[model samples]
Target: MSPRSGPPLDGAIDVHAHYVTPRLRAAMVDAGHAEPDGMPAIPDWSPESALADMDSLGVATALLSVSSPGVHFGSDADARRLARDVNTEGAEIAAARPDRFGLLASLPLPDVTGALAEVEHAFDALGADGITLHTHYDGKHLGHPEHEPLLSALDERAAVVVLHPTSPPCWEAVSAGLPRPLLEFPFETTRAVASLVLSGALERHPRIRFVVPHAGAALPVLADRIAAFSLISGGPPIDVAGALRGLHYDLAGFALPRQLPALLALADPDRLLYGSDLPFTPAPVARGLAEALAADATLTAEQQRSMRRGAAEALFPRFARPGPPGAAEPRPDDRSLRGDQR
Candidate 1:
């Protein structure tokens, strides 16, 4: 296959991408949603706009998920409707750009029945690549009872659950002094991952694949604490770090060019994925991340290929096809399965 412009890497799949459809935008505007003050303005996104950005960034394909603060702001009925609409729209984009796009379906969380219904439609009916979820729903984390049904469904279907962080409950109440994305976003992602790891959620749903963004949040730094908590706290002592290595981590928002050691220390470079939190950060940031991953002396060429492309194939194989024979696979234990997300 021909290499994409600006990079010799083949099959670079952006595992974390957002597509804010017109339907979702209209619902948000009509509801007059009150979001965290420092929450960056939602950019206007459509399939065409997303494709152009990916092409320019040399991204061969992207697994599209809903942007943060998804339909949860609306009433239960409105939330359900918006979820269906956006999911359908996402599928349409994937159909149009078979080689360039795939969808991570959105759902109205905490509404157990609605979430289940959407899952069936998005996964069984629409054929989505996976499911996208916010770290919390109105401050209720993943371990909450309300999420059990959704988790059960994903586990049963072996779905790929892409976890995105949103400002926790009442973030707007104290948004004046803090940078929401800069600090709160990663923290929330970290908090959710830790909760899932410690609360037996990961154990309960071993088949469920989670792709954590922002360089796996602070997970690499806190691996020891999590491991200790697992042992001392009487939670599962089942190798928290190893379990984390089994999970997928995407390199988005890690643009400093100096964060390589921190990322490499947590998991092998192969576990790292290529993601552009586009429309939030510029395309250059994505390119810079690709460059940084290449320059990290700790990562070998084979490992860098996994970070840039192979891991994404593991995360969403329906969308991210593997490269030619004998190419390095992301993980030895990792297996690609046919699954869907609702």
Candidate 2:
């Protein structure tokens, strides 16, 4: 079938785009991840190709990140080296086209010390717009007490933390041999968010702006259920809906007809952001989804515009205005990056 077409996204900022450098690919392959996370293979990527895809999708800037399986395989030392290499490569990619690309650096998680060190380098030295974290690392979800130090550092910086889902610990038993992305990914996202809420991490790290991807996965549908049960379970006295409203959600995967509506029910409309999940989703498929979102009648034009660009501008104001010809846009100053709006 021919690809669907719609109005150009027109300066939209895609919050969930991905990148895989040669070093990262080689490392994954060496670690027996020739097929990372049970996928057929890692998608091919390059700066030129990414730029072409962005142009076709009308994305003025894409915040690039390394997707699941992350940098850690088993050894913390190896993971640290890989994380540094990939983050450096990502920073270089964004540096080449500051106006068209921004980076969300990866961390060697499940290794808190290494992660904290990388966080310092990624933000203070690399000028990363944010940090990309998986829902869990080494079977430990984001709310684990061990991650408190890392969380505290992020909170201090008011960092933008984008949560991408990885294969959950019980994938073998529960996945029925199917790829994790189909079912396990969203479930893992829900689990991680719940962990943060029940553990009081969300409350403690209020300054950290967390961006939940895949239209908040299963969180929207289960928000009320969680809130109702938390009281009985003696979990933190947090208002689930209010907590969701305070965080941002990205429309990256197939969000129409169900996910988007459910997410809107719990999340603030102004906190919605655009995400293309490119390379992994394939450019054509991502474009079709973007077209569908643009044409969805449920959202008013203003709402659509906000998802496309406005909300993201508030978070990454460096892209709000264009730079001079042949000049690279400056990295967002810490104050501008930590915009007043959540």
Candidate 3:
């Protein structure tokens, strides 16, 4: 199908957009991450550019986050400081245009104490919409025991946690020198989710709503395999499919033609949300993806509308009513689902 030249879906809520503050770019360069996670360079970002991209792509409001190679850069103190700075910047942006933007604050992971402190401030003081967590911090994935405290706190708040994939510690041995995003990122997401399930983090902290990006990122195909392996290994039985269905997923990054179908088989259709991994994904590419999804014939009009906006509205009530100026009214049946924090 030909991609749309104009906006594809009216008032679409983009859940996977990224924002790179100038301070964050500078910090990345200083930390020798000019090309973070083996990517060519840090993408440029600003509130104005973000808004313009949203306008072109039909995004009414974008929940912004700091993408992979998150705030941490080794030093606990420095990571904490950077996390605060970027999160504050993000909050300011969201506050300036609440109708157009929302923030998913970053954290200094691998430093549980610092992360917990920032989480408190980000939610309590900044009124952030949610939090963004990298798949792995240092050498530890999200399921690592050290992160239990942070997970518990998030669960208590029923925080919306978006998982951004980063290069695993073994990237050097496994990545074959190619950029990690090209292949390893999807694998990393799968590994981190598997760890969360196998380690009982998902079961223990059921309220922490995890939004898996890239349409569950290699997970749908591997869900049963992970579950079967857990049993075969003489480990405690893990309901991997249930864990996946309980979590939310964002349709970002090459979701159609294969990934989305696989994800739908394992995930509740209502749990699907729209995501445009902007900035990192160039505007043209992001728009193309959006247009393609909009044009996909397999999804009924209602299903498309749900993925584009309704599902997100169900998750975020703030966007359910009194939408931004000129926004279209949602269909009566669109928001049938409740905002249960599952």
Best candidate per TM-score, number? 3
Give me the displacement of residue 87 in model 2, in angstroms. 0.8
What do the candidate models score in CA lDDT, each in turn?
0.75, 0.87, 0.87
Q: Write the per-residue lDDT of candidate 3 for residues 202-275, one digit (tens) a residue.
A: 99999998999999999999998988888877767788888889988999999989888888899987788889
Off by over 4 Å in 3: 1-3, 322-327, 330-342
User: Which runs in model 2 stand beyond 4 Å of their true positions?
Assistant: 1-7, 322-342
- Ten contiguous residues minimizing lDDT sum, candidate 1: 331-340
Error of 1 at 129 (Å): 0.5
TM-score of each: 0.86, 0.92, 0.93
For residue 142, what is the lDDT in candidate 2? Answer: 96
Better of 1 and 2 by lDDT: 2
lDDT of 1 by residue, 120-142 (tens): 99989899989988889867888
Please give the distance, in angstroms, between residue 83's alpha carbon in candidate 3 and its true position after superposition. Answer: 0.7
